[model samples]
Target: MNLRVEQRALAQSDQDDVVVLGPNPADTTFETTSTEGAYKILGVRPGLTISVFDMVIGADFAGRFATEPCVAIDFLFEAAGQGWLLDADGERLSSLPYRPGRIYIMAAPKGAVGFYDVPVGTRFKGMDIRVDTTLWQKLGAGDILSSLDEHHSLHIASGNGTWVGVLPVPPQLLAVARALFDSAMVENDDLAFEARALDIVHASINAMRSIQPAATIPPRDRRPLQRARDLMIAELSYPWALDGLAREIGLTQKRLQTGFKAMYGYSVYAFLQEQRLLEARRSIESGEVTVTQAAMNVGYGNPSHFSQLFLRRFGVQPSRLRPSETGKYQEAQAR
Candidate 1:
């Protein structure tokens, strides 16, 4: 077992609402349900998280999802939903209903994303693949990252100029994608799923290479910007000042802003908020602190506001992770 998994213990509640908080932030699956649907997110192998979801939620749900730097490949078997792909500034880069019976992917740079308005009684069947940025980049996927949405799905050959990023899955590749669903259902077959995932990535990248790239913004100093990110994560409780963070990491404020987004796919403070929320989720799941304590530990001063942010980021109230909350959670699930 991953030590981080043991330490964090994120999936404690045996609840329908709370998602299993594994090491992969990109395990942040497509659209999670409050009480009407269920998903199983598994880190089937190293640097890989697979989420298979079947959703028909009881109420209207809008999720604010974020992830650490990662790439997501989605196979939407069936969907009647809509959402946007956002940028570093949280601007909508694309807004369209999810195309059903297709495979789409995005590189979650800042990965601050939203998925919602899934109407009642509608079904959603999909598999989401979340891979480490380093792994995908090592597979020569870095150059293609910009074309992938910073936070949403990008479609290709849609006649709209920006929609030219997704690679259409033809018959053969769709067969391969469907095969993965079978392997996911089988017991103890991690390698099978891993191999299929790689094949899907290779196929998508090959198809995507010929397309024009999105506008590029180069990181001025990768090392310094990375250091600044580290400093923020290590001291999230400390109120961060962009200028002070830049000075400490030996970069100008402007360079830090631009370079941080260029490298990490989000602005500095946005990234900090992401890290803080992730830590708070982990802390909440550990059952060692109240949600308020967990929030305060991660630099959030107001518990009510923290709960709101927590629900958005995680798709569940933070209290759901506590062991004591399992009965209520299970009751909700039973409904």
Candidate 2:
């Protein structure tokens, strides 16, 4: 999860609440003129950082961001639109949308590049936690350190190496996030900040523990069905329309759909989304993207969605990821 974030300065106005997250070279920040958004990045402890944000899109948005290696826990109170994890070549790697009212935990050994375009009037409110707390065999989960069992998603290797887990926000954590977003706490106040921040990490670890890995299924029918699967993997962007795919595999459309569901555990359309996300995750972790020309990399393509209006609004164009100067390292090395 390459979190595209901002640093906030908020104020009340006559008509609407104004949020300004101007560009600053000191810490991580993402800025755009068209969107009305709020963001505040606060340092909770030496190895922990938390950001509170709320925004409403003014145009279709597409951009990329970079980060230092750390675990990302995102709690979205309100959200719209979806994001894509893109690889070094600007191709999408993953597209598992952790929906609104849920917390998304992404454990990355290194930083990544991501692309997403929110609609012209959609809204977003959330808190992002960057973690490198206590260590458990290089895993930087605080409080719950060694309590994680083997069933935890981190213990299992995923298709693209990184693990993304989605969990409903516990009430205790939700209260804290809402308060932070509402600006109920003073920026400089350090009272119980570490404890609150660690609370989030602890909750994330517990939620992650409950996520069991999917059981691997053997090939159901290895002849034409296997051939069909291979073809899909080879050209993920190619629209493997039901009629064409079925004819190529010598099976009826119904048989092909049924066979795909039985073999891959998803419909043909869903499988494409799965593969695109996997490929993107692998590529995103490979390096940093220049962000000179970020394009929409979803399964479907339309000219209007990725238009000049979006580019002018965001002023970002990340084309591909390259080797980052800040190389990967152990959990606590940077701090």
Candidate 3:
């Protein structure tokens, strides 16, 4: 394993937490902890790193944090605060609201800085998998890398530019994350984790590819698609038909279908189903509702059919996501 670990203090203050896991320049696996929280990073192979961060901030730590430019795919499973990314000249590049179940891809040039300021008691939790350009090339994923380069100016070297792209955390990607999280708990073999981490990187690349031929929507067409998206999000439980949706958006059914696919790379109803199931999973995991209730809330009246769909999407039953039962399904699979 080409692992390397180095630790450094974020600032001179005694209260500032030191990266228990040294800031690795290459492949490494380490865990860090402080009064506020803990973090673990695993980078056992070339061109890939997986990290889990759970932290709480009591004050502004802007001047204390820094990072190298790299591509990052993030799954924000839990968060209760806000963060910001700043360019070398201190221009704000992005404002990150720590919303649960949100996934995003971002590339920051080498000179960029990131910091978070949360209330004294706010908590944050997320998983980040970083893959460098070297790995992209090695995997023969020039098209995927090129897409990012073209869309976000990601090809620009450090200090030149930065880019961020946000998308819903797809069910398939979530399953990979859950598997990685589970492996972290019961698997001590470095090879095992490395394999799983690589799987994650591959899945991330494919997720980007699956949303192919990214194009900008003209304002005239964008408005109606945005309206339709907003309506679905606002009323997931609403019984929606293709004709009704197109009429409400002042477009013919065929036009709406074409425009929706062009804008989102998914059919109108397909996107809605994804959103509904994602929301239902979140609701079940958060303990805000029972499995059946979650199904009903997402417009599924038949609990049995809903459960089957949930299983198909997430590879686990809705009940498995509850806090008390988390990972039980994975354990059963292992057996």
Residue 238 in candidate 1, Cα distance off native in Å? 58
Once model 1 is optimally superposed onto the true structure by TM-score, how far is the C-alpha of residue 173 displaced, in angstroms? Answer: 1.3
Candidate 1 or 2, higher TM-score? 2
User: Better model by lDDT, 1 or 3?
Assistant: 3
Error at 241, model 1, angstroms: 58
**Better structure of 2 and 3 per TM-score:** 3
Misplaced by over 4 Å in model 1 are 1-34, 86-93, 146-164, 212-335
Kindly provide the TM-score of model 1 when superposed on the true structure, using C-alpha atoms. 0.48
Candidate 2 backbone clash number: 17
Query: What is each predicted model's overall lDDT from 0 to 1?
Result: 0.59, 0.51, 0.63
Top model number, TM-score:
3
TM-score of each: 0.48, 0.50, 0.67
In order of lDDT, best first, we have: 3, 1, 2
- lDDT of model 3 at position 12: 20
Worst ten in a row by lDDT for model 2? 12-21
